[model samples]
Target: MSIRIPPASWAFRGFVLCFVFLSSFPGTILTQEVTLDSIRIFTTHDWFSIKPTVYFQCKGENKTVFPDVKNTNVSYSFKGEESWQPLTKLEGTKCKRCGIYEQDPLTHDTFDEWELCPSDFTAEGTYTHGREKEFNATFLCHGCSQVGPGSNKESGTEKEEERRGMRPAIVVLIVVLVLGVAAAGLVVGYKYWRKKKRQQEQARFLKLFEDGDEMEDELELQNTL
Candidate 1:
């Protein structure tokens, strides 16, 4: 004899089956969100200017793989700015590999070499001379889909320190220049004083010689008489 199942029991079973199927393939059932793991801002002190290099660390869902960074776009804005400005992708090698290879004793083959990966995206640009010192900046990747958590706040502090560092050097240069001018003036004044004293001595000696010559001429005339 076959047993009949209740309508409610059949519906519950069907719901359970659907739940199990979705749990087994969570990636398909759940939406994947792209996020930024971290961000770094590198400030380089160029002659009379500061260059800002922004690096972005993008991470996809565990089962999802990220595509080439060139396919994505990025932009940034200062703390008080109303709009976002595009960031130009920097060009060059962004990663490096350094490891030693060892031969397997039994297989007589080398092991897989390990490598170090860099940030997924990088952009280079210049900040206004004092703008970096004034406020923090934020970066967005993939057209504002991924954002950095105000990671560039340190940029302002670094810029202030850089400017502070220059102060001592400028002060030193000014001091040296003042000392040099004072030394030159002293040397010139000494030379002028010596020349004037020498001229006075020469004039006195000439006057004395003239007086003795006149006396000798007068004595000669007396002897002749």
Candidate 2:
């Protein structure tokens, strides 16, 4: 027996399947913004400058200047109220090439360069980078605190939960398909039984009519005798 499904219902089923498949995987990787909490300059890269302009930059991005951090051995702290509040955006624990530089008339001088990773930060949402005779600075990203090596367990748990959540949907889909097939089979079987019963009744009726005709012919022959 063949079951015919409507076109609109097929489209709806396709949409639901796609939604479930897409939802099973992780979502888009969003970048977290990092801000400068505090910074101290151990030494100045530019000489003959009473007050030098210092800034930090990630690769392929614009620089975030520290207005107060100009003199060496001076600790500059920020309340995260700077015009350029967030220094950079980091995706998960991935690292980016970033450095502190001193602005110059001709060329910018680099104080320190390193690969900055979100995993390097501590649970308190603080990360410090330092170079001898160059500079030392602390950065903050509250989002980073929830990431790192320790977050592996949490991530794994989340993934497991997602998998578990999908189980019931799949089971329901299977059960529905099975029940549809069973119902279709039952309808076809019922139709076939009804047709067979009607054919048997018609055959019995024709047999009874033929017997009556033979009996009538025999009685007429007796009468003629």
Query: Top model by lDDT, which number?
Result: 2
What's the lDDT for residue 105 in model 1? 23
Candidate 1 versus the native: TM-score?
0.32
Best by TM-score: 2
In the range 124-225, model 2's lDDT, one tens digit per residue, is 889998888788889998877666545332344564676687678678767776675566667667878998999999999999999999999999999999
Clashing pairs in 1: none
- Which runs in model 1 stand beyond 4 Å of their true positions? 1-154
TM-score of each: 0.32, 0.55
Candidate 2's C-alpha lDDT? 0.76
Clashing pairs in 2: none
Per-residue lDDT over 1-225 for candidate 1, one digit per residue giving the tens place of the 0 to 100 score: 957444456446555755664455312243311132322222322233322222222121111111211111232323322222222221121122222111222322211222212123233211221123222222233322111223222244664675576567557656755675566566667868998999999999999999999999999999999
